[model samples]
Target: MSNIPFTLHTQNSAAINVSLLYAASSKYEGEWSGTPHSHPYAEFFYVLRGEIDFQAEGEPYSLHEDDLIVINPDVNHTERPRGPGTVEYVSFGVEGLCMDPADSGMWSSCSLFHCRQSRSEVRFFLRLLLAEFENNLPNYEQLCCHAFESLLVFLKRAHPQELAVTAPKRTARECSAVKRYIDANFRQPISLDHLAEVSQLNKYYLAHAFREYIGLSPINYLNSRRVEEARVLLRDTSHSISEIAGIVGFSSQSYFAQVFQKAVGESPGEYRKRLRRGRQEKQE
Candidate 1:
């Protein structure tokens, strides 16, 4: 019998502090039910079966089996079944980690990678981490976290040009500050010029950097915030549509309706009516 030898080496490295917040596996049949939304943490997805289409930051991409994607914080994205087959995938919500590419042509917020050659290895880590989370035995959380960090190491090695995990740049920090400001004062008459004054960054650079870091231009982000608040008010309050529009910082109801439809796929009145109808049906 031939003998094989293996050696292990150790090197100094800084600790990457990341917490695996959650993991989920989903299978969607025909008539997928997904909404455009975003979160403030990094998310990872691996397609296990079939094809799916992902719209991230207004760009469309079709992904097949053995493919993975990483989305940065505050990036708007949605996914649905592609073609005619069922879609199955596993996703992980991670915090305290961000990814940027060494080259151009790939948005740091939405990075897609095809992994046909490393399918088995990729699936192994994903499935293992998922199983550990599902099992929830002793030290399962620790195990899952370790597995996820190891998976990141593997991915960086495999996609060196694409997965250069690094700290947030200065611009990203400034953009984040602006995002927080918007969150607090979206109902005000905020503009790019005002934001520039607040952040002390140029208007053009602030717009571009905000989009690069947050996945939407400043105005777009403001509009999205207004839409989100409008949705809540429509569902909960009996306020008139126009009043809601003005309260959410829109100049006119017509413009509010236009932006709301583009973001939510329905007019505000229609959404409110549908919600009320559902509530009435439940009560009846």
Candidate 2:
């Protein structure tokens, strides 16, 4: 699956940020609904009335009243009204959430919930959330945070599916092995499939676990290592830019320049020139 290369491996998730963004009760139009969109934050759709077809992770699901659907970060999805029917959905998005280790594993693993049972309890929490946002009473921020956390607690307790499947952590030995492999062989054409095979992991598990620990896709991490190697070549060796690009596994000089600038905030030639100029000034 295609995904953005944004990740953070944080030990203290309590420092992670979370917010209740844009809680509104409205009827969406029946025409074309909205274009497929993805965000870096998590979002949920709670349908109080009416039915709509929702798509997540490229799969279509029919949602009805009391259904809670979560769309995970960076997952592309869209909604379409069912046969000119309007959907009354109360939705909110959150970012940088923290949970217990097991909960975090479950949270990272699952996104869509076909239905969260207990309509009245879920409805009550939804109303409470909307009220908290609207009232803005004193200490409302703490109140809202508690209310949101309670709502998730209710969902998790009510639905075992959320806890059913979790990603297994790669042993430190295996993680170190993968890191060493990347460091030693970033110049080779290393694909996710190849890494998955070497690490004895499925593609999805490998991608998720690797990012959970390393904070980057294996390919991006490999690119970073390649860029660091290229920097050394540019500084200490007499290789041409094209030759350096080849040595670094970059297909073309232009692509190498682009990745180098993105990683180091400067072009290869500019970086080399600045370093040489600094050395000369030191000699003077």
Clashing pairs in 1: none
Model 2, residue 228: distance off in Å is 38
lDDT score for candidate 1 against the true structure: 0.78
lDDT string for model 1 (1-284, tens) is 11111221112243455556778799877767669887776789899999988976656888899889888777778988877778789998876566777544223656788888877777888887888877778877666766676776677677876656644344755676687688789999998999999999999999988887667899999999999999999998989999999999999999999999999999999999999899999999
RMSD of 2: 18.2
Candidate topping TM-score: 1
- Model 2 lDDT per residue over 23-75, tens place: 66777656564687766656778887788788754457888777777765555
**Superposing every Cα of model 1 onto the true structure, what RMSD results?**
12.5
In model 2, how many backbone clashes occur? Answer: 0
Compared to the true structure, candidate 2 yields what TM-score? 0.50
lDDT at position 71, candidate 1: 81
Most accurate candidate by lDDT: 1
